[model samples]
Target chain A: MAEILTAKKLAIKVSICLAVLVAVMALCAMVGTQKISLKKVFAGPGQEPGQNIDYEILVGVRLPRVILAALVGAALACSGVVLQAILRNPLADPYILGISSGAGLGVITAVISGITWKFWGGSPIAVFAFVGALATVWLVWCIGHLTGKSQVTSLLLAGVVINAFFSAVIMFLISIAKSEQLRSTVLWLMGNIIEKDPAVLGVSTVCILAGIIALFSISHRLNILTFGQEEAKGLGVDTAKTTAIAFGLAAFTTAIAVSLSGLIGFVGLIVPHGVRLVFGPDHRQLLPVSAIIGGAFLVVADTLARIIVAPAQLPVGVITAIAGGPFFLVLLAKYSRKVSWLK
Target chain B: MSGIIEVKDLNFGYTPQSTILKALSFEVIQGRFVGIAGPNGAGKTTLLNLLCGLLRSKAGSIKIDSVPIESYSARKLAKKVAVVRQEFVPVFDFCVAEVVSMARTPYLSTFGFESDTDKKIIDEALEMTDTARFASRPLANLSGGERQRVFIARALAQNTDILLLDEPTTFLDLKHQVGIYDLLKRMQLEKGKTIVVVTHDINLSTQYCDEILLLGADSSYQYGSAKDVFSPHKIEKVFGVRGFAGKIGTEKFFLPLGKFAKDAHIITTNINSTTKK
Candidate 1:
């Protein structure tokens, strides 16, 4: 009977998530530059043979951007789910371990130094971002190990220090940058979805997808980890190795998302928490649902960022921040009293 | 050699300069209920950690079913022993059933899906722990005693032969403590589980445990039946108090004795009459 109830709950959650995804995708497709009809949107960017321009605009440009936004959003949200579980902190996000700042630093460094080598004519920024994110996470791990206190607080504090230091270095680089480079760097900080080269998008998708798969595969371990490290170990989880892998995957996905979308925040922090509130904290459900909802949320946010001001696009980061800030405050107002569990 | 758990000359510490456990050796016979007692920092938790392979011993060896503990992988060890620690903080608002299902993790594959047998085990653990009524309730909403029971339920779901509990009654009131002890005793007797509990409540330990291990500073340790280990002399030596043991309603209790005031006069005849009564 309990199993039946759980199955029903899971089914309800999946259906709701699918419904939300469909609604958001439809909204995203219908609200763009031309305000295409639902029929046109559903028929999917191609109807007649001669009218290739509309098809190209719809399929080539808008479709990829929306798909990329969804993929990156899902990746970030799922990474947040795993990280929060492993750290045993509700406030933990993909960026809490310094992945975003590290990737940002790498991108800024590459941009400032004019190191523009492309792998198969793709953006070097994504590659540099991933490498930098992994390197910084390793550095944080080493520091934590050297100190012999790898507690969550110590790791978080280390990330904060590294984030601040990296931000300062990136700022210094920006200060010395030429006008064109400085403008690009500033715009990158604001985050944009335009000009995503196909090759860059493909590589970023693959990286994010791999990280998502790795994380989802260990969803059960992630759930056990929420009981804290010692209990998790008692339950036979190799706490050290599993934690490292989960953190690495979260960092990797966040790095790819940051590289592709340029520091889209709050989606990683908000979407998973929201999903948990609705579906409860079973990672087998939470991870995948958070991913789907996160993808849909970002796709809608990106669409709004495009159409909100027309012709001139607002930065996707700004929209997420604006949306997530209020959502987070509402969350705090509702759940802050219950956070004594942290004690 | 036939015991479920055996530790020999086990020495462990956080650092070389500060040893917590020194040559600690004990055996828990199959299906025995053993209690470990000591003052704070008596290395009770460290010893339990060593037994469960949560912390590697610096010296000596630990064996489960005559196999070197270090030789068993974490999953194998978990299948043999489950620990309910003193501090259990759930990071998420998981339902009680979900929390209980986590105990089946050791028996599951890498994917860790709950099989029909696994679900039955979880249900049984929940029912055994008296948490089945709140199976749908969020764990965060449970009282401290309830949450502690949920942790135990999760451990029970592991279905191990040995259960190690560290200060399981620390935060509970007297009623809850007795309830938990009674539940643990039932589990031991009914399931034939080898149970080891670490606690500061010597009286409770003496009442419930078949064997008691007393740990003290300066590399001192004693292991025997509760009657043998909880004598007045050993109690005074360990607690630095003059204590009197007496029976009340078929239960034994130890109470600290105090010296009379210097200005007060003791009446020997009255004392003899009171004792006779």
Candidate 2:
């Protein structure tokens, strides 16, 4: 019908998704291994120590973890949407930047070297991961630009090579490490949501939110980029500059997420596909909508991980890989009768 | 005035040892339908990419309306030219209107917001291409011909003065082939848009183009009206197969001849001298 996609319409769509995110976060916060009352949240703030364990559990432990899941979810999914567009590969997920392997190498090296795993407020692994992942991405960036032309193909090739090399190192470390260290390393690789310093959450929240806004600003150019490199240039996009901007923003956000959430899988891979399957692939809607839905998907996954084991929590990453894969396939099977995954 | 598009001494290759186009020179006047026809690996597509500024040449210059192409910003150039690539199947399945809306990228504000005028232009493009019937449908739902038409509609939505296409007929049958060529011809005639197509279909180009630029192996080229440029010997030399030229209603067509044909000498016309330009 050639109806106008007015500003009002875009706002409404995003608002609806935001509403759903809020609903999911609220529901997940209510039902954890430990019973918490929503009434406590509305009741007057706890002014003294030894305030009800219910208040401490809800506000300190459960609520922060749920919020962290949402933030990481949003970051990974948003990165997935933009990366798929610019890289011209639907198989590109947050980990395709080699973030998981980079982070994995950090965890494995620290464990194998006999560095205490729980020191620095249980953040030594997170610190190592944040540095290693960012360093690997920086290495890929330099390699992609060695010819003074940072082509997406060059960047992608660099990522693949770096990912393979780092993963091999991680596997070698795991194979030779002692049993106790290997156990901790494996748990770190599997990924989980844990309570964090308020400062870390606040800083990550700012970085990720800014990254989403930056990506949203460039979504229109990304639509043209899907037409391949030469063709995108033919359409008058400054392919080099636009690609650089999108890649840098998406990469930084993915690094921040992995540093915070340790290596949550499948949210980055499945959320964007599910969102694209539901809403068509227009980046204008796809970016924000995928981000909101990605947050909710992870919250639900984390909540189920908390309860399914009942007093013994599973890593949220395991639930994402286990539950999200079948759920995505079901969606694919139901909808693929109409349209293909990609052609 | 020479033409709306001009090129001189253009050279390009992925590397110095593998040059694709060598000192290529050509021009297309405004409102003319020009076809770039050539054999495989002869740089037809490379030349097209050079024309649109997708790839820059190291040796020479391309100009639009006497202004060097490098001087034009990407957005400014996009308003003057729109390109329809060969079989561009994107990873995601955007609907017809959604894909068409992308053509307005160069025209949108820095924030990429659309105005009423952009919507009107999009609507008109759909109507012109006859794709408005399935404007709401996903591109996957359309037939081959319909999808090609939708791509053309996207180009038209750019509202450019010049349009370029690469093998719009690939993977299409005869009817769709004719339909696509007809659409391009109509655009040239009715809308006064300069058109250039790089294609392997020499026969169809012979019927539709005002001028033909036949590129051959080793950088040799012949540019003239189809009548002046096409001949059985040239076809055999370029494509490495013998062919006979047949005439129908002022239009010439080529039919390849091989040793397998029965009694091929009897029907041979030896019309090379008769067809001399």
Q: Of the candidates shown, which would achieve the greatest DockQ relative to the real structure?
A: 2
User: Over the stretch A120-189, how does candidate 2's per-residue lDDT look in tens digits?
Assistant: 4664877778778878888887887774454677878888999999999898888888899878788888
lDDT of candidate 2 at residue A57, scale 0 to 100: 79
On residues B1-277, what C-alpha lDDT tens digit does candidate 2 reach at each position? Answer: 3229988888888787887777878888899999988899898888877778777788888999889988988878888888888765566777888888888888887658678889999999999888898988887778878989999999999998889898899979999999999999988898889999998887899999999888888788988887767776787678886656777778888777676787466336563533443
- Return the lDDT, model 2, position A234: 63
Candidate 2 deviant stretches above 4 angstroms: A3-6, A111-122, A142-157, A176-180, B1-3, B18-20, B231-242, B267-269, B273-277
Model 1 TM: 0.92
TM-score of each: 0.92, 0.92
Candidate 2 residue pairs in backbone clash: none
Error of 2 at A330 (Å): 2.1
10 residues in a row with least lDDT, candidate 2 chain B:
B266-275
Note each model's CA RMSD in angstroms: 3.5, 2.9
Q: What is the alpha-carbon lDDT of model 2 when measured against the actual structure? A: 0.84
